[model samples]
Target: MSLENNKAFASVLTAGIILLASGFAATMLYHPQDLEENAFKIEVADSGAEVDAAAPAGPVIEPISALLASADIAAGEKGFKKCSACHSIESGGANKIGPALWGVVDRTRASVDGFSYSDVLNGMNSETWDYEALNEFLAKPKAYAPGTKMGFAGLKKVDQRADLIAYLRQQSDSPAALPE
Candidate 1:
C-alpha cells in the first residue's frame, strides 16, 4: 500500500479505537440508573400498599418578642431604609410608589382606602394583623400570601422582620381598648 493511504487508514483506526475506549470507559465508570424504570416503582402487599421516603424535619419557630429583641430596633431601622424609598411612616403622609405605612401594624391587610391592592391581599378575610403573621409575611412575601403584589422580595433574617414589625408598632397606635 502507498505510504499516504497506509497513514490515513492508521489514523482512522486510531480514532475509532479512541472513541470506542472512551464510550466503554464512561459507561463502566458511571453506571447511571434509569429513573423511569426502577426509581419510580410501586410495591403492593397483602394487607395494603405502602410507600417509603424521607424528608427534612421543619424548623421550630420562636416567639415574636424574642425574635424582635434579637434583631434590635437599629437593625430594623436600617432594614427600613430600603422601604423608605417606596413608603412613608409619617402619619397622614401621601402615598408614593406604595401607600403611606404610618399605621400598618395591627391594621387589616389591604384595608387602606384609595390605594389599590392585589386580589390576594383583598381576599384575605382576616380580622387584623398580628406579630406572628406579620413575621411570616415579611420573611417571604409570595410564600406567605401566594399571590401578593407587594414586589418586595422578603427579609430572610427573622430578627430583622421582628424589628421592622416593632418599628411599625411604635409608629401606630393600638386599637381602642375595649371597656368592660
Candidate 2:
C-alpha cells in the first residue's frame, strides 16, 4: 500500500480500537450486581394467625350502588377529561377512538351504529350497560373484556367511577334509574 493510504488506515484502525476498548471498559465498570441482596422478604403468617399470608394486599372494593349514592356529578365531569381523548359523552356527539357514550348507561353493549367494536365486546351484545356492569368495566376494561380494543387503563377510584357514571347518566334524555 502507498504511504498516504497506510497512514489513513492506521488512523482509522487506531480510532476503532480506542472505541472498542472504551466500550469494554464501560461494560466492566458498570456491570450489573445481584439484586437478591435488595429483595423484599414477605413475612409468612403462622398457622394460628388471623390473616392469610397467601391473600393479596389491597382495599376491598365496595358495591357500585353504595358509591353512586354519594357520587358528585361535578367531580365526575372533571375526571371525564381523561376520557375525552377517546370518548364523546354529549348527545349526538361523533364517535372518536371509542364509541360515543351519550346514552351508554342503559344501552346494549357494543350497539353503537358506525363504530367498530372488538370481538369480545360484540359477543357481549346481550348485556346492558347497567350501573354494576359499567362499574366493573370502568374499573378495568381489559379485565372485564379480555380482547376489548379500548386501551384505557381504567379508573382505580370507586368515587371517580361513580362520578363518571353519574355524568354519563345525565347525558341521556331519560337516564336509567340508579341501582337499589
Q: Residues 24-90, candidate 2: write the lDDT tens digits.
A: 9999899787886657775332454487779874444556787777889999899889999999988
lDDT of 1 by residue, 61-161 (tens): 45575655454666677788989998888888877777788777667877777778778778874756677777777876766666666778788777778
Model 2 superposed RMSD (Cα)? 6.8
Residue 150 in candidate 2, Cα distance off native in Å: 1.6
Look at candidate 2 and give me any clashing residue pairs. Answer: none
Each model's total of backbone clashes: 0, 0
Error of 1 at 18 (Å): 39
**Alpha carbon lDDT at 82, candidate 1:** 88
Native-structure RMSD, model 1: 10.3
User: How far is 52's C-alpha from truth in model 2 (Å)?
Assistant: 19
Model 1 TM-score relative to the real fold = 0.59
| Model 2, position 75: C-alpha lDDT score | 93
Q: Each model's TM-score, in the order given?
A: 0.59, 0.80
List the pairs of residues colliding in candidate 1: none
